[model samples]
Target: MMIVALMASVSACASTYRVPREEAPPEWREDGKPTGFMPIEGSAKSFPGNHKERGVIMEFAVENERTAIITNTLEWTGPFGGSNIIPAGSPAYARQFSLRMSSNYGSYFGKDMNAYNNPIEWCVPRFDKGDAVCIFWEGSDRARYIDTSGGTPLNASPTSPSGMVGPMPQVQEQAVDFGHQMKIQVIVDTFRSNRITVATRISEGDDWSSLGRTKVMFDEGDTVTLKRFDGEFKLTAHRAGNGEITDVDVEVIKEPKAGRLQTFKDVLEMFMALKAAEAAKAAEDTDESDTASSPEED
Candidate 1:
């Protein structure tokens, strides 16, 4: 009976399982198509003249990967001649500078999706007054936006919008069932001060609606863990103060023995408990052996 009970305990220990980490899908890439005039080029042009002359040129490139080259020439007639190169502050130079800035800035897509040749328009500024330019670059993800102007820089404090630029939180796998508890943890190094909230939602049909929201707070440099166990669902994060949001899609599945969806914490705890139980059993066995070897207490 003891052997059977020990085997059952061992099996239970072995049966302890956790969810595996989910691999986030690659970000979708937007198609890049030409919408405006061809970019400028760096080349020389010859003109009809009495004396042969050559000119030096300078060029500038814009967002569309196009270039615009400007040329300056010098001419001579008699024994000695002087040549002057106009500086950037000059009217001629200013005109070119203004043109380039306007072209590059105006070409930005306001709110209209059609104006943008790129499909990912999240970062694009909605053409309106008080919109400030905001740029976010992560790995291959590049986004530019015009945020609400008049406010301070987004990264003024730890809870500011710029502070969210750090590494993304860790995601855990979940099981699918009607009433089963599904817990998801998003590992973050630091949590914003202005009431950071994490929410879960499902992509029903086309749009995503809310499941619930949880507040996340952590000490300085400590990792913040957010857990949610409810009806099978998807999850996302949102910063209410800055209106920054993260959309994550997750699917729930049910398989006995809890597949790879287990988390590291759960596995570590189980291993530790198993080791402790084994040590206690060994001590008990040694005590029994000593008693059996001893003669009757006389």
Candidate 2:
């Protein structure tokens, strides 16, 4: 009887934690889609040409098998400049920076999906007035949202007279498979006087379960990796510097080999190539116009 009981226990353990057989989903989405949150493109372009962006890019490949790479690029889409403008002691201000995570198959800034496009995952600081950052997941059937602070469904109602702006969707609880392997990247946005703690969980209908590892703290320019696998959980912490990403702690799992971090010189070279191409195109157009307008030599 004891032998039988031991065997049963082992089977249960194996069932609970096993490396995924087929490739896992590109990312772990708590629900189906996000409502209140703006699209990734919208947020990045909020300031027009004045926007400054800094975050890591993750990529997956199928060479020998499935392998992934992470590149941390702290770059501005255009010129880089700024400090938090919210007034001190203002109603719009918060004691801690709000951090939220998002993952997608395409460039977070891209308008279309492509495999060569790196999967963009990063934690962003929400500064929009009256905005609350929340956690979300996408199951096979539908997407769901939850208030990170209150653990409530993120449902919204109409507020404007013109009816142009719709009400925020009310949160509806649902079951989520917490056992699935997940890859999450956390980024630090605003550097305030205080550190911020982030907590996560998985839910099923009205029931919710805590991830074995919960709670992480972050300050500005910090990046951390959160991934779960067969009985093994991995976290990699790092601090971003100019053209450099330094690992903050000892990494446990082996990371896929990576190329050197991009530098300002690389950016300059890109700009130069673009200018040269443009110049060549313009010269060709001018020559064609001259031929069309010139009188016949005879």
Candidate 3:
């Protein structure tokens, strides 16, 4: 029920909020036969569209002395606890959504997925005077909760009148191989449309390759300058090459501008407020129950 619990809040605030782009993705097939593998919702929303739909995808080129704050792989999760809901009207929402959409799939690669504790992860881009692309270490930890199976049980008991508590099994994390280094690339286009497509790839030392790679387009906010790409982008186009679908690689040409960096403070504050409201409602119900159960008064 993580989806239900999280979506409840998202749905309540989604009246005017912009969700990821709703595009019909071509079915993935192998050797021209149907693979019957349809990605989960929100996975393919990384393509071009608008500020709300595609998130912040920036382009970078070689010889540019700017660096993007590469997302911390595996260990990091979205500020909203894997729930995609922020104040839709706030400027922070645009930055947060872009980060979440860009880095949501970093943990699906590698042989051992137990290293990550969060269900989903996001990153905020930063520009620094350095190389076109850079990698950074984010520290390592024991691998636990290999998959979503570690989530709350359907029949879990309530933690309080306002919240539910699930059993946290004492499954100690085991020593596993996890990549803490984040590799980033900013690809610039040929014409000036004020949009950039962010492409990324991950590799585990030489023995392995990209751990859940994806790219999405976003409008360069006021924080950065717009560089010209050769042509315009089609929001509804399918991402395929060589008559078959293939993953994009990390190739670059300069850093166009400085982008925003996302933090968890805003999301944490919102979640706390929602809990306070729930507790207040629960307390009111208790008062009514007490009055109903009282013995007849003189």
State each candidate's clash count.
Answer: 10, 24, 16
Considering only N, C-alpha and C atoms within 3 Å, which residue pairs clash in candidate 1? Answer: 18-261, 18-262, 19-260, 19-261, 19-262, 20-260, 20-261, 20-262, 40-67, 176-253
lDDT for model 1, please: 0.23
Evaluated at residue 243, the lDDT of candidate 2 is: 29
Measured with C-alpha atoms, the lDDT of residue 123 in candidate 2 is 20
TM-score of each: 0.17, 0.17, 0.18
lDDT of 2 by residue, 49-131 (tens): 11112222221111101111112222111112232221212211001111112235422433321122221111212223213
Please report, in order, the local distance difference test score of every candidate based on alpha carbons: 0.23, 0.24, 0.22
Q: How well does candidate 2 match the true structure, expressed as C-alpha RMSD?
A: 25.5
Order of models, best TM-score first: 3, 1, 2
Sort by lDDT, best first: 2, 1, 3
